[model samples]
Target: MKIDIQKDWGKIKSHFRTCNRRNMHVVISSVDSDQMPTVTPIGSLFLNDDQTGFYFEKFATKLRKSSEQNKNICVLAVNSRKWFWLKALFKGKFSDYPGVKLYGELGEKRDATPREYRAFQRRVQSTKRLKGYHYLWKDMAQIREIKFTKAEKINLGKMTKEL
Candidate 1:
């Protein structure tokens, strides 16, 4: 669908904030044997936004671990559906979709803030975080950029685009 990407980020960001059990898209960038950049999908990213870069809690999966070795990444996320997600990705690049992305390095830190601590507790107790969370964030390396795509084409079958 043709889209005008001007006023869709707010709606998309809201969706990411309230999602549960939804699979978020991740693009972990690393060097191949030849030292060229390689990107792939890694599941387990959770959105935590307050007033800065959207924070994500990730376990040590192969993708995360591999990315950790390189410290460069560009992650993507969108509400999933048959029609909306027609392609596994957009335009063969990181910023091709109407979603939020963070381009930077990775660092670890405690999920120690008061509000986050309680939320973590609830997550663990509610069986939401699976094995539970330990060092919270993993800092956003550099949080190089964070933004959303336009809303004119974010369709989900019967759900009209939120333009």
Candidate 2:
């Protein structure tokens, strides 16, 4: 069902946070020059209060290439935690949305501001002690902005009928 992206911004933000934690990343889909489609898994997406967000562009080579040609993109965030599913299964209904799809267009690709960089650091601070953290996020200096236009709550039979 259609969601009022502005009105439900708080819920959207919470859902995305849970999605990143449970699923590790959100899937971003874009089209190439020939209308060919591609999907990129991005873990650094952060939503602002104004229905806009950005993602670190360090390793998304294909997404960068495709975004240059086609700026339109779709982001899918799913809450796939085993306990969430198990609870819904037992109750025969979901208390909250299980997923959401965001429709947006790519904006400027620019260097992240100091504040943005700090936010990114905070997001990944839990993994700072890991060996791969430095290898993966040490050089995430650039970000591509996204202005979201619409949101759709995922529908799943009677499980999500109330939502």
Candidate 3:
């Protein structure tokens, strides 16, 4: 279904939050120079208020390369919460969408602002005690912005009829 990014921004952010809470990675799809499709899982995507978002660029070499060849990218964020799915299954309808597809064009790689950095840190603060947190995320200093063109609800036949 068509989604007004401005009007449904809150719902979009909520969906991302739900998925992020469960540590579900957002899948970014892009096509390479040779027209081969590539999908990359990213854990650091953050949505902003004005139809713009960014994701930390650490360890996303493939994504970066693909974006360079083709700026157009599609990001899929699914709420993988078991309870949410179970409730939907039981009720035969979803109160909200299970996932959304964001169509956008990748922007230039830039140094993340301190505010952005802090926000990322805050998102992962609960995992501070974990060793891998420091190794994997502490050094995330670069980011690539994305300006979304459209947002669409992922519709599954029969199952998502009421969404």
Better of 2 and 3 by lDDT: 2
lDDT (0 to 1) per candidate: 0.42, 0.94, 0.89
Q: Please report, as a residue range, the 10-residue window in candidate 3 with the lowest summed lDDT.
A: 154-163
Which candidate wins on lDDT? 2
- Lowest summed lDDT window (length 10), candidate 2: 61-70
Per-residue lDDT of model 1, residues 18-84, tens digit only? 3323553445455544557666664334443322232334443543455445655555455554443
Compared to the true structure, candidate 1 yields what TM-score? Answer: 0.42
For model 1, the run of ten residues with the poorest summed lDDT = 140-149
Clashing pairs in 2: none
After superposition on all CA atoms, how large is the RMSD of candidate 3? 1.3
**lDDT string, candidate 2, 101-142, tens digits:** 999999999999999999999989998999999999977899
Rank by lDDT, highest first: 2, 3, 1
TM-score of each: 0.42, 0.96, 0.94
Q: For residues 1-163, could you state the per-residue lDDT of candidate 3 as single tens digits?
A: 7789889998998888888787558999999878999999998999999999999999988889888778999999888888988998898888888989999999999999999999999988888899999899878999999999999998976777776
lDDT of 1 at 52: 27
